[model samples]
Target: MPRWTHYGSVEELMSNPLQHLCDISKKAQQHSITQNGMEEAMDYLHKLHIGDTLVTSTWKTLFAAYRAELAKLFNRIGVTLDITSNELPFGRQDLTTPIHSEILTHFLSTSEDRLDLSSSNLGTPRLHRTVASPKPLLVDLTSTLSNLKTYSRVIRIAPEKQQFTYAQHNHIVSKILSSRPTPTLLPKMETLLIAPVTDLTPLDGVLSLHTIFDQSKQHMLKFARDPNADEDTSKSETFDPVETADKLGVNAITFQILQSKRNKLLKFEWKRVMSDVRDPGVFVSYLYARLCGCVLFLSSSLSMI
Candidate 1:
């Protein structure tokens, strides 16, 4: 069953909204589908699609993990997928998508609504997806934070098979560059790396975003090597998360939205770049650039040749 939105002739749909669909048509689009060396881990997922789940009696799997990665790469490179791929969710159903619950709940509690949902009211943690009158309330807060700290969660698909929210974490990267600093003896190098997030880790904790940003630089470095191995990077780089939400957390819906946007390319910060490699460890990872509606991912991967 196709959700049909009338497009003029056979080619009209590709020209709509952003003209991105047209862009992807002109591109070769074959970069994110590489197979990882065999390991007992998640190698198979490197080939799965996000939405197209494979159904079995007991469980399911997305066809190819690399598929979505391909999609994300296409997005980053300004390739608009075919018009069909951008279709809205729950096609043709009266039940269109809605606002994010976690954000709405926060607004409800603190805004004009004045209602609060506590853990006691949320009950057991499963969504029936059954619509109720005046809307069923989102449950209360399970945890409270007074200071910054690390956190983690492991989720189960059914009675078992837990998925660990391991490295996917977030935190407040406070004012880093404004403090006192000593002068360097020489100049440094830099480069910008952007990765579209096609997925989200459903967990909660105050995480130092630097953790993931640092990890990504290493991953990229594995693929891209610099000739100048001894260049300084400490003062020659910056890794800024474009979307700066003080309270960084998302429920299922908002969480998924975060991922969807991550796959889309948008121009982000248009600041000056350092043309040298000063410190690889000081590179910025623009993880939330998509979430913040950025069109370009700008970073200074400053390393000399």
Candidate 2:
């Protein structure tokens, strides 16, 4: 008999949904699990707006990192997997209707644990027919996340170079970060949210509010640090929590307000910024003025087919 090593069986790969999802791309357990650019992912996700069905493909540079595993898993599952060498998931025929085919049904029927069910990717319904590919803004955002080094936050440093003024602060935060930032996906944005702790600063509810401020959900760490602050934030919570949260800063209430408001603001911001891209460059820094999720997303979710 010719010397031959047996190819692995599909028992685990085919039977389990979670396993199948993970195995969908076989290089690793979650090969296709996007190692999104934390900031970029946020931007792209915003552009997508919530409630939109993401049309991606296993044939782009971004997907190159996860392609093999996906192919293996699909092969194991007995689906005809046709994708490009790069492995991105966008602008392909697979995204078309049939909404009922085997693979199509599998994807449509599967309830994504990580998928934000907040309506559209940007959190609202978009009127477009299909998402286009090679959306540079989305790609750039992904690249930014893939290159993350450390968590970047905006804190009030002790009167650096220029004198402090709201215009300057706005200019500094907005102008400086207009271009997409690069690095690993930032899972915890709270870690990057900080302000200078000065002697004059009162250790009131604002002291450690971002962590605890929960209009809907309680953030234990923040509450433990300062239990007294919650009283004021509860009243401010509303449909437009971002503005309320921003004005209040990152207190327990503000943080909670943020948690509730983030999806909404991201959606609004995404729509406002992506509607035309008349300026073209505006998309890169759409979230320069955003509250959070401004820089964190998969490095590749663009396609125009």
Candidate of highest lDDT: 2
Report RMSD for candidate 1.
22.2
lDDT of 1 by residue, 1-305 (tens): 11122212122221111112212111212222112211111212111110111111110011121123223323332223221221211011111112122222322343332211211222222211212442101110011111113122111111111122212211101111111132231121111222212232322322223233333445345423532344443434332222111111111112222232222221212121112243232232222212211111001000000
CA-only RMSD, every prediction = 22.2, 21.3
In model 2, what lDDT does residue 104 have?
Answer: 30
The positional error of residue 140 in candidate 1, measured at the CA in angstroms, is: 38
Residue 221 Cα positional deviation in candidate 2, in Å, after optimal superposition: 20
Best by TM-score: 1
What TM-score against the true fold does each predicted structure earn?
A: 0.21, 0.18
Write down the worst ten-residue block by lDDT for model 2. 294-303
